[model samples]
Target: MSGHPVLTMKDVGVCYFRKRGFLKRQKIWAVRNVSLDVRHGETLGVIGRNGVGKSTMLKVMAGIMNPDAGVITNYGGYSVSLLALQVGFLPYLTGRENVFLSGMLLGMTRTQIAEKMSEIISFSELDDAIDYPVATYSLGLKARLGFSISFHADPDVLLIDEVLGVGDAQFRVKSAAAMRSKIRSNKTVVLVSHNLETIEEMCERVVWIENGTTRAIGTTADVLRAYMSQVKGRAVPDPAD
Candidate 1:
């Protein structure tokens, strides 16, 4: 990665309002004062237990959700997108139709979607099913189609949630290869996953988040070592170890 930052978050925070029935409501902060930078062509992994606001941070970066505090700056006119399963699909629409719809939602033009339809369908392996309504698709099918469309969208910055965990073994391998191809093309990626091994393999750096805050951020080895130590209920090992 170069010295330039593609995207940067400065003291960002997001909150949700939960209603408890009658007149009771509570304000919960999903993200808290998290600051980080995403550099060009770097694959940054975010590893954490569920409900730690990692996904929320991606939403903020993708401009889907705004932070209640702080700021997110985008440099170089980069386009950011969040790729997650079971999203961006219109249940009543056919897979072909949803391709256009979803692509548009991801900021692609109609002409671009038309041009890439064949490649998207082939990559998704949805052949005949591409004509069927998305609601009729199985879980794995949804993941395959969603991932194919997003991966081919060619965004400047891609924020991947746990969608990679959804597909079958073979498809996972294919998808991982596609992601590597994107990385090779010098695209910026922010990946959030429960699989630390994949994070270690795919990411140059990893961020460990706990309870809506950054627990550690550094090289993949350093951050994952610290994260795994906590997971196993042991003290963090020395860097030399």
Candidate 2:
């Protein structure tokens, strides 16, 4: 890690309103007071239980959604891409078309996407299905295409949310290998996952979120130990031991 921050979030918060009977709405804060810095060339892990706003935080970081409170500063104008199963693909468009669309959205030029088109399709293993409309695709098929496109987008900072488990066993292995390659290249990454083992192996630092706020932030071992202690109701064994 270079110890230089590529992105920084200061007291960032996102709110939602849900209907609560007639003329009344319940205010929900999905992410409340989250502050952290994403250092360049480091893999940062985000760990939390379900519904803890992990995905919400990622969306804000990717600029897909604006925070209702606080500010986010993107130093050096680094490009960020969010890798998720539910990629913003036009259902009516073919897989090939969606690849171009998603790539452009990630800041890739048309010529760049065109050059990588064949590789993306081959990596996805979509074959002839690449010409088929995405609306006709199964969940796994869509995931394959999404993963393929994002993998080759080559953004400065990549945000991943529980997408490593997508696709079949073979594709899962391939995708995992690709992600490892990205980390090895010293690309900045923020990973949100429930797989503690993956996080432990890949991330140098971790941020633990609880009740829509940061509970702890530190070395992967330290934060994971504290998180596991709370979740398992017992002490966690040190990795060194």
Candidate 3:
């Protein structure tokens, strides 16, 4: 299994239902006939417009959803899905307690979380707020805490949905550095973002998805250049001209 891909998909497909009637069902695909590979120590970036199933693809890899048709093989262990920040979070719990709970769900024990609690709080910069109930936190604060907790889990594969929590100018610079650091590990990271520059900087390879299908896959520079060219031509007509 040493040579096996960290994650592999073959002829994958997923469909959602559109209500025609209570008894009759209609299907709308979120991903169709998509095949790809993610190798250990590499970051694979998936980009597409809204509602194009970017998050759905990551969920399938994270084993959150069973594809309608396809084969996904993982040698062993778990993959972390960050599609929804703090997905299983309990509002009643304090941020610190929630972090511990999240770590445990990721397969760690109390002792394990005890070993990394300080690092988690420190990295999140939550400090005193860590004792506050998560339900009382703002969206940004929640996102930050969730990201911090996940980082403490020591994931083998980290699937991130959006870079919303990566913050502003200075934070983005720092976040890019963090993304680079993650890619260097013997782990797989699959990122989905609308941030073209972030994708270009962090990913060596890319998969272009459009309308539930893989439109293209290739080196970052080439795929991105194509994406930009397509978008540039569609720029609104000049009113002055």
Q: Highest lDDT: which candidate?
A: 2
Q: Which residue pairs in candidate 3 have backbone atoms (N, alpha carbon, C) closer than 3 angstroms, thus clashing?
A: none
Off by over 4 Å in 2: 234-241
What lDDT would each prediction earn against the true structure? 0.86, 0.91, 0.75
**Candidate 2 residue 36 C-alpha distance from true site, Å:** 0.6
Better of 2 and 3 by lDDT: 2
Per-residue CA lDDT of model 3 for 11-97, tens digit only, reads 789998988977988889989988888777777888888998788888888788999988877756655555345757899999988
Highest TM-score against the true fold, candidate: 2
Candidate 2, 1-241: lDDT as tens digits: 6579999999999999999999999999999999999999999999999999999999999999999999999999999989866467999999999998888888889999999999999999999999999999998999899999988988999999988867999999999999888887899999998999999999999998889988888899899988888888886543333
Ordered by lDDT, highest first, the candidates read 2, 1, 3
RMSD of each: 2.5, 3.0, 5.7
Winner of 1 and 3 under TM-score? 1
True-structure lDDT of candidate 2: 0.91
Give candidate 1 regions above 4 Å deviation: 236-241
Candidate closer to the true structure by TM-score (higher is better), 2 or 3: 2
Candidate 1 lDDT, 145-186, residue by residue in tens: 999888878888999887764589999889878876776666
TM-score each candidate.
0.91, 0.94, 0.84
- Once model 2 is optimally superposed onto the true structure by TM-score, how far is the C-alpha of residue 189 displaced, in angstroms? 0.3
Model 1 residue 83 CA deviation in Å: 1.7
